[model samples]
Target: MLARASAATTALTDPGDRLAELCARIAGRIVFTTSFGIEDQAISHFIMSRDLGIEIVTLDTGRLFPSTYTVWDETEQKYGRRIRAATPEAAALSALVADIGINGFYHSKDARLACCHVRKVEPLARALGGAAAWITGLRADQSGERAAVALESWDEERALIKFAPLFDWTRAEVAAFCAAEGVPVNSLHAEGFLSIGCQPCTRAVAPGEPERAGRWWWEDQGSAECGLHVGPDGRLVRDQPE
Candidate 1:
């Protein structure tokens, strides 16, 4: 299945075409998780504008910026479709807050990882349950950690295929596409929040800063991930070459 799926996408240059073909070739549910970022908006457009059957969903960490929510609403209105939300489990969230004092993530890296595990990784597990394929907006140029991302890969950990349709796209190209396509994007993007996430965990980048520099800026450089794409050993889950 992995070899066939990889071969099917290897020849496709257009993201929309690749997605359409993936849906046709793969059975069971295909899920796309969006964060309302510029990259995500482009993928959302490719999937929704073409009326693809892929499921669109987001992780509402309950601490997102107001602008993020605004764009989320605007994107749905523009596409005339609802993006399902997978929020943190209530009991788990409450317990985390009680254990860490709400903003304790600011104190240590471990605390932040725990917060992410509860708010993002766990919710993503629920969102991806029974999914045959998972689609993400990961671009290789976003950060050094993601520089090796592939267009299609077999996610052994999740036991499903993972697709990064825009993996090779540059930030400028993505921005241009969103502009030409008139896709609704977060207003914060223009304000230097190139990589937006939760309000407390994110900030605007300075000149010459990396796109993801804004996220988890407090942590040491090159350690800004939230455990969403990495394995238990804290390394990216890369594809095994066929």
Candidate 2:
């Protein structure tokens, strides 16, 4: 399936066409994860407007901003479809918080990654269960870690095909499309919040900063990843072994 999808859609210039073909090929077996960012809104618009059957879902990390939830409601209203919610395990979260007090992630990288593993990664694993294709709103220009992203590839860990339809699109291109299409956008973008994540871990980006600079700004790591989409080498995996 991975080889076939790559060969059939790699050279396609139109994102809509690629998505259409993907939806046709996978049909009810595909899932799309959205954070309601500008890029996510664009991809959601394409899927909804084109009547694609990819299931839309989001991880409710319990630390999101109110504006994020508002945009999510707006998206459902505009698209006339409910996005599924994935939550972390109750016992694990309670244990972690109890052991480290509410914000232990600030103390060390291990704690931070552990929080991400419980809140985002584990839930995402469940959300992608039995899915043949996993759709993401990742764009190459968003960060240096994702600079070499491909349109389609295999995800060995999840055992599914990963498709990033907007892999080649720029932030400007996404914003323009969203404005023209009237897609519901996160209100924080206007305030320079180029990347939105958990409330405590995110902030507005400054001038001349990368798009994801706002996320995990307190950390001094080389990457701002949350462990959900990164490989074993601590980089965004563009190509997975088939």
TM-score of every prediction relative to native = 0.97, 0.95
Model 1 ranges off by over 4 Å? 1-3, 6-8
Clashes of each: 0, 0
Pairs with steric clashes in candidate 2:
none
Residue pairs whose backbone atoms clash in candidate 1: none
lDDT of each: 0.90, 0.87
Candidate 2 error regions (>4 Å): 1-3, 6-8
Best of the candidates, TM-score: 1
Query: What would the per-residue lDDT of candidate 2 be over residues 1-242, giving only the tens digit for each residue?
Result: 44457467778877788998887776447999999999889999999989887889999999999999999999999989999999999999999899777999989888999999999999999999999889999888988888888888777677788889999988998999999989999999999999999998999988999999998888984799998778777767677536
* Tens digit of per-residue lDDT, candidate 1, span 16-62: 99999989888889999999999999999999999999999999999
Give lDDT for model 2: 0.87
lDDT of 1: 0.90
User: Which candidate gets the maximum lDDT versus the true structure?
Assistant: 1
lDDT of 1 at 166: 94
